[model samples]
Target: MYQPLAYRLRPKTLEDIVGQEHLVGPGKIIRRMVEANLLSSMILYGPPGTGKTSIASAIAGSTSFAFRMLNAATDTKKDLQIVAEEAKMSGTVILLLDEVHRLDKTKQDFLLPHLENGRIILIGATTENPYISINPAIRSRTQIFEVHPLTPEAIEMALDRALTAKDGFKDEDVILEQSAKRELAFVTNGDLRSALNALELAVRSTPKNEDGTILITKEIIQECTQQKGFSHDKNGDAHYDVISAFQKSIRGSDADAALHYLARLIEAGDLISICRRLLVIGYEDIGLANPAAASRTLDAVLAAERLGLPEARIPLSVAVLDLCLSPKSNSAYQSLDRALQDVKNGKATTIPNHLKDSHYKGAAALGRGLTYQYPHEFSDGWVAQQYLPDPLAHTRYYEPKFTGRYEQALAKRYEELHQKKSSSTK
Candidate 1:
């Protein structure tokens, strides 16, 4: 039977591991733990194709303890009890659980007693967030090590290793063109297993010419992995990428691209999440410039909530288009960011004494509200006064952007106030 290329090229040792040099390198955390045989319960958290299973296998093979494997997706509470009993009899059993987040609350809770007693050194592999899915007690007992997605360079290196390794492509003389390789990497999106599978499929499908050399082209690579792409799931890198693209499209004033990305998310059953995010972005990115953008987003979210899927898509499309076409300004967001930084860096100035309360007892005795002027009593219904503290009186935090209807009025009012203040001071 022919083994899959990914399985055939699986790394057998720490040195054979393709990526994650930060953990498995010489004198690293994993190396130190393995060397001292002081293994603790650990959670391997990362996306797919990052070698969580391979690392567990390497640890099991290298250690002297008996190794047992189970999948949380299928295992029961009784199954966990059996493993716990066996580990109690055995000196130290390394229990490797795959998809540990799939275990229900009861099944996950079953491992706690064993884990606390040190009966088994649990190594859990999960694609989901452990904090959210796993029990807090289980999480507290384990050392969480985050495994990152493979970089493009790492994927390329793995492909090269697979081509030349004794176990993989030994007899095949398949050479991937530079363009084909780049396309394959891009399609895989840092998934090592997917990259290898694509490479294997490309090599197997390509017809050799009379020259006896098979050329893998970009077209063939694209054909191997169907290019009918969809928006990302809510919990992974794709989620971040799609949202980033959506925001960038709006910021770049590409209404078409913004609409396209919105449609992609809506069609992928992410309408509710997309609506919520749009509402947030409308306020955060498009605040006050076109305040109506935020209202439109809220309407979209309400429409999605009330009507649900399929029918709610109309409002979602409208909201996305309105946000994209709305007058854009990030000045308020940037000003808040600067103000927050100043506060964080201990640059927050005190409130001016005139703005302090004089109605409270003994407040007027401390010169509070001594020279405060009421704007309503003035000729122009505006007063000239130091609103900010003495130290930051000249600090200009909010600079209005002249883009939308609201901002235009705000700019005029601000200019009039400054003119009145200048005349009063003179």
Candidate 2:
């Protein structure tokens, strides 16, 4: 009759909840919603151990509405119909559906009508992105509340509760060293349930001395949790951690590290996510400086999707190599940042009249194209004229890097223009 430590230590109230104070604390959105009984259909989106289910349960238990629970992984349309029928009789039913994204389009459509009629207040829990997984119609009817992963501090608090809770380790004479507790927390990676489970196993495995005391040291916790298998399944912290490491490696220009992380994801059956991320990085990070990088990434995505794993490794390797070998530039990224900063500082410059559109009537009379020089009409396909707005005419925002095949020509053209302008000024 040994119950799981996570179950025994589950928070029973909002006050008992270990983390996410931002949402559940005083004056927060969720708090206001709960207190005011403005329980609209909502989607609680977050990774595991972020207390999605706990929040739903706390709200349902505290509210006046009748509550019902269902899991999309196992629940069927028939189950939903039964719940819908009961909800109609109850006036306002809070339907707590776990893994709501697991419901197919047909099943999700079944709830749309009832949701629209205000018969059921759907509180959904999904670890996946609602944009891709949840039906658009169903998602439209619900307010999306994002719940982030529990922080290390939050996980530590949960561990403390588990060690001392009556139903958890009250009967055991176990003491965990501070170092051992930190190690468990780190290994859990902000996963409260996993942390508690590791702590329970560590305590259980520790041998009691003849002195009648059991000690959980760093070594013991490490040993117990080290053997635990890690997965790259979409729902868990490992998924985010691996992808984060991969992105950081690319950003840092560590080709070897990027490849290693890519291999890890591939081995864990996360090929699709890996492919998708590569495509995103191509545009978001490796853009313009090396245009070929984006094209290569897109090709890899198509290859991975078409061929599937093992075989897909070929294209994955190609994409990673291209990203690693491509000349790095954050100029595009920096330009956007600079533009936003300019706007924030009230530096909106006026457009030069010469560069303004001259196709419209009265544009020529207003001196729109009076001094405008067409670059294509010049011998070198370059013209020395003011391109920037009047206020920012002397400001230079784009400074091309002298790296990569495409950017080398860009760098040369920029230098030539600068020389020409400097000579003319003298």
In terms of TM-score, which candidate is strongest?
Answer: 1
CA lDDT of each candidate? 0.81, 0.81
What are the models' TM-scores?
Answer: 0.65, 0.65
The residue-by-residue lDDT of candidate 2 on 229-259, one tens digit each, is 3445665545787898998788777899999
Per-residue lDDT, model 1, residue 108, is 67
- Return the TM-score for candidate 1, rounded to 2 decimals: 0.65
Candidate 1 structure lDDT: 0.81
In each prediction, how many residue pairs overlap at the backbone (N, C-alpha, C within less than 3 A)?
0, 0
Model 1, 99-191: lDDT tens per residue? 887768788667787888888889999877777777777889999888878888888888888878888776777788888887877677667
